[model samples]
Target: MTERIAREPGRSTFIQRTRRAQLIACAIDVLAEDGYVQASLSRIAKRAGVSRGVILYHFSGRDDLLDAVVSEVYRIATEELRPTIETQSTALRAVRTFIVGSAEFYRAYPAHMAALREIVAHSRSADGTIRHSEHSRANERELSALGVLFERGKEAGEFRAFSTPIMARTIRSTLDGLLGQMRVDPGYDPVPEAHEVADIFERAMMRQSE
Candidate 1:
């Protein structure tokens, strides 16, 4: 298996990477349209206009392909949001931008977001354990980033003193909750809700006014 999966005898790394990216893109679409249970390797291959061997050549199996899908979605989202988040001078502003930025990201890459949610919800290993638990890294990073923002706000006297862990988790949960709601009710508009959530947090985090 390793030999079959190794770098093609003469294929440049760039070509290999491009092929893998294309396969992942196809996988994302299939998973989004069909859900994890229904997204067969052949289905993804048919969508990509490739043979099943092509997908197997790029990925070890379904697990590997799904993992790549989750990783790519996170990579894309971070690429979209990080620059804007860096622009905010105040920690509170960063939090607001983070939520609003996420809404923008969802709007821009609805397929990626939907595919990720589906894979996370249904992908399972042979042992029946959740297959793609690696997303915890992204979750942890968000919590830590939010923690940093809270600390900065505290230092600047912009935010009230509070348990940063709880506050960070609360904020993260609120944003994720909006997405979950949208999955159930398509009528949910996240951008406005993001703004409202940001307002609620800003007030909660801000120092009590004189």
Candidate 2:
């Protein structure tokens, strides 16, 4: 029965992991629909078809559950954004592609956006480790992609020499503002606006032809 005892723990661990995933998914749905303040463990458990005690067994409290949901949202967002960031034909194109792709991703996944907004709104008083981690990862990827484009343009003498970090931050901030406007105004179409932003960015950075 040593083998049986070992198997039992392995099976228990698998079951626990599956249950936790289910609870996290339910939490995402609840938070997406109701926001953080209204997301309760009881509601999550009910949505997950599990008992409230089961949720408590996996997560210490509602805050812990919310944290896990935020992490998952970031994970999914990164996945959605990574492909466009990695595959641009030029740095300028990459930046524009990233901006437009991100807007499209949010439009397709409004629930994820809602969940993200709730996390930001509610996490003001909590430790910011997870949010900071997510932001850092996104910034690193975006900056790296922009750096590739900046170096390419500089080598071609088609763009002005400047700090990639600063430029990346400026572009990112612009995209963030555009996204905020799109989110606030349902009638705003980000595609045309994204192209305009890209044109302005390219013109600002590129050297004038003699």
Candidate 3:
């Protein structure tokens, strides 16, 4: 297969796209089941029932393939959450929906959530720096968006005076922790935990009756 692809570099676009998607899916499965340290290109290729050359044909290298895995997972999550979050009547509803929707998304896509966490925890950049050290661009973007929601709630008098950045970070941290909990405890139910979190935040942020 690799030889064929190499010889006919101008393969049909549909075939190329399908192969890339298959490789990415295999990578995610391997990452979720085997952890980041063990999810080598060869492992992914074996899982995909293809040669390593097939992966190289589609992606530059392991990092490039992992990047695609992350991008694809996030793309799916965003599409899943957008409708629920966007249709809310108020900022508070949006915030709650975001929280619950995110948990539901994790539950629905456990493998994806696990693969993403593994990638974020282990993937490094040039110069041996952690890609998600302190806070990666992806984290910053999520925090910034959450901060906007908090600010909107405050401006509308649905929430109390508080630091939006701090609250955003707090929520993000809690959600990340929830993923960790689910990984370790088979009995753990994130939906209930998510509801608790949503309730806590709603109460904490609600405006005091004047």
Question: Largest lDDT belongs to which candidate?
Answer: 3
Looking at model 3, which ten-residue stretch has the lowest summed lDDT? 3-12
Candidate 3: list runs displaced more than 4 Å: 1-12, 124-128, 132-135
Cα miss at 172, model 2 (Å)? Answer: 2.8
Ranking by TM-score: 1, 3, 2
**Deviation from native of the Cα of residue 43 in model 3, angstroms:** 0.6
Instruction: Write down the TM-score of every candidate.
Output: 0.88, 0.72, 0.87
Model 1 worst lDDT window (10 residues): 3-12
lDDT of 3 by residue, 41-138 (tens): 99999999999987887776787788788877877888999888888989999999989999999999988988998988786766787754322655
TM-score of 2: 0.72
lDDT, candidate 2, 151-190, per-residue tens: 8878877778788888888887787776677567766766
Q: What stretches of model 1 exceed 4 Å from their correct place?
A: 1-12, 123-128
lDDT, candidates in the order shown: 0.83, 0.71, 0.84
